[model samples]
Target: MSTDLSSTPPGSPGAPASDKLDRHVLVIAGVVVLGAIMSILDITVVSVALETFQREFDATTAQVAWTMTAYTLALASVIPLTGWASDRFGTKRLYLIAIVLFSAGSALCAAATSLEMLVAFRVVQGLGGGMLVPLGMTILTRAAGPERLGRVMAVMGVPMLLGPIFGPILGGALIDNASWHWIFLINVPIGVATIVYAAIVLPKDDVEPSETFDWLGMVLLSPGLAAFLYGVSTIPETGTILDAEVLVPAIIGLLLIAAFVPWALSRRNAHPLVDLRLFQNFTLTIAVIAMALFAMAFFGASLLFPLYFQQVRGEGALDAGLLLAPQGLGAMLVMPLAGVLTDRIGPGKIVLVGVAVITVGMGMFATLDAETSYYFLTGALFVMGLGMGATMMPIMTAALQTLRGHTVARGSTLLNIVQQVAASIGTAIFSVLLTNGVKNEADPTALALGEIEDESQLRAFLEQTGIPAEQLPTILRDLTDDLAGVFSGTFWIAAAMVAVVLVPAFFLPRKPPAEPVDQTALMGH
Candidate 1:
């Protein structure tokens, strides 16, 4: 960022500041933005289509659901290596190639005729897709310099905010009017254009970064997290906790992940995939942990909301997506202000407030009912969005606050990995909870109401459960409403977690005294 060319040889570091204000900034930014949008959308877009995948493949809920987990796992596996890859290659080259790869994966998914093929291709998409978000942050922050980062983040966060909203909406519309294939197909034009634009506008950095890939670390970390998540996903699948097959894989995964710590810490300059040493930076450590937990809570609940609207409230997919739009809009509205405030006040204080509001929002949702008002449900969503808006930038700033220059790239990449892994855990954990409660409660409600008379007995016997008789009449209508509350409980727990995380704020060094802004990186503004 310091335009002083003495330190960085042109070919070694990433794309240096362009000589003039080339259209390349916009080009790279556009590609990065689209990449970010695609990656974010992928996480949620498939939720609506899960049933379709199940029906078409003749798969059970467990089998079809892997479509989501596979993508997430692939993402977690590859994310830690992003910074090293970019540094070794070149940011612009790596970013462009990543987009193309992601698009190709999307195309593969669209062309797939079978369930197995689709899941495999989704993993490919995840591999490339995971690069966009963290790489986007690294590029933007470096591009903007310290002076303009607040505004840059505010502007950039718009697409990031909209991803969750559009995923369901887009999925719903595509499934309704077109078909599931369109969800993946839509990325092609965007990807092609991003590649072309990048080639033209992005500066050519012939950086030959020489470094070794952390094959050993990857061997342990990726499979470890995958096993843990896969095991968690299975709890819901088998509808029981005692499955030894699931338990063994999961426990092994946990042990492997635990082993990665000492393995990574021992590597001095050779960052084995990820540098766990970044945790020593208090600001980044707290930010990553809080965000990881927040994502776990947020994404875990997101899966259930659509199900609630469709299954319990009897709304269509598109309608539910539309209904959910207001919340995202609220987050979009508030994020810019939060960005500005983050710069004026410290990120620590700003994030604290954001986390508090988020907790309140989650608590509000915790009190849902079968006949709650749309305003009540949507309003709670809006508050949660506000929390996301308020929290995202400040928290990002906190992560970057202490890491000066290119070190921020490594921090950003590691931060991204943390959130992805945390989110999968969140989904798996909440899904397991939802499955258990629903399975345990379904039959009792029927029996108590004398609904399982004789033929119904066959269904009960097969289900191996009973529903309370008085609740049997409305059980189908109320299942999602009850599930929503169960998921909300996870949010409340995350909110309470903010208190513990806040303690680390004391250590963030006050904005380095009289810090000079990095003007070369600030060319866009």
Candidate 2:
């Protein structure tokens, strides 16, 4: 409720004056961004190698999936405690510990002989990876202060935006040229370098621990988030939210979260794990809501592009990854400019423009077919990227700019938590939509394909479907049109989700912060 700008120093430790950009700030930002990118890139990189892990360990699909599942759950579980841990230990110390933990986990994952061991190691990796992003954001925000937050976030957003696009490409290259182990092993050098750099450059802040740990809040919120995420993750496999696999954990998680609310609000004796009261700030409230909705649309739609390239276009993983590059490129091109614009005019109008651009891109995707031109598809993706570059970091900077220095860490944690949950929900919802669309279209497609007669035409259909020539007559049928229809339908749904953000975007602040503080002040300088 209080702005209290004068209580803290001008910027974080080693931070420059509020009006200046200096070497120290850039170096610190670079190191933080590198650490964050390593963590995020690891998430998508492992996704591409799941099958490789299964084959190497001689494990079933369900068992091998734990490699990813465990990591996600661990991430969810540890995130709620990040604010407390940072305050208790100091951000620099905690970040270094996280790097060490992640590096060790990666080494163990590479050396693991069994699937179970691999999954366990992934948990360690996840715990460390989970802390990197929110904590990194907190550190960067403190260093940049409100005035320069938009530009600072632009730098930080690069890895966050590009990692998912590039992860599959890197994973495929490693898998084809080397072994699955290389996927995990690759993190070591990056992690070590990040640790060394951070240790040398990152300033040690004075620790201001809360009077007591909020054990009760943690007990409720941690599992609540994990359960909800776990349930959401199962939706693609279960095919519906109503399925017990999705319902049970989700219901329990929601109940626990519901229970935590009253408890946190009542606990005046100690700080809650996350200050739910931050929502009382209207700007912060709108920013969080807009961000959650954007995550659902963005993460959900991300799944569709790769699948479209692989299934409809019959491209391999690496090829599909290459095809998805334009989206990231478009985003990269527009982000720096977007950052400056956001600082000048505020995030509201910028986000509206972004949402509009994304809608156009998604609309184009909805019309895609087997014969759709490569240039058109890439152009649409590029437009979507430009929109995303404008939208994501601006919204984030807006949220952090609204918070007081003491609450920034908790605010960052809350934002990350919402995003993780929203992404899961988005992924689940889109997956179901695509799956159902495919199922509905399959029979009609089979009937149409039954009419194929020309030998060359039938051979081409077989190649596209990846079915045997012998089975083409009785068992296999070309579903190219059907898939195109299904993907297009799903793309429309994604577009619609993105469009919904415009309503909330209008509620954001109309201009930049009225009075900005010194960046170094957040470090208790």
Q: What is the lDDT of residue 216 in candidate 1?
A: 76
Which residue runs of candidate 1 sit more than 4 Å off their true CA positions? 1-28, 206-209, 239-242, 267-269, 439-525
Residue-wise lDDT of candidate 1 within 1-525, one digit each (tens)? Answer: 123222445344332343222354454566667778888888778878998998888998878888898887788767777877887887787888789889999999999999999999999999898788878888877665543355456666777777888788988888888998998998888888777877776667566645677777888888887887777667666666579867987899889989888887773435567767767655567778777766676766666666667655768888989888877887888887876555544466666767677777767766766577899989988887887787766667767655655466677888787776666666666667666655555454533333334776656654555434454447644555554555455445545654444545444323421243232243221
Which structure among the candidates has the greatest TM-score? 2
lDDT of 2 by residue, 1-525 (tens): 323233336764422255445677789998889888888888899988888887898888777878988998898889889988888888899899899998999999999999989999999999999999989998988887776677888988998999999999999999999999899899999999999999999987888644478999999999998998888888888788899988999999999999999987784625788778777667878999999999999897899999998777878899999998999999999999887777666788889998899999999989998779999999999999999899989999888886656578888999999988898889888989998888788675364455475888777777777766576445432476678888998898898999999999999876766553322243222
What TM-score goes with each of the models? 0.83, 0.90
The worst-scoring run of ten residues by lDDT in candidate 2 lies at 516-525
Q: What is the lDDT of residue 485 in candidate 2?
A: 86
> In model 1, what lDDT does residue 433 have?
67
lDDT value, candidate 1, whole model = 0.70
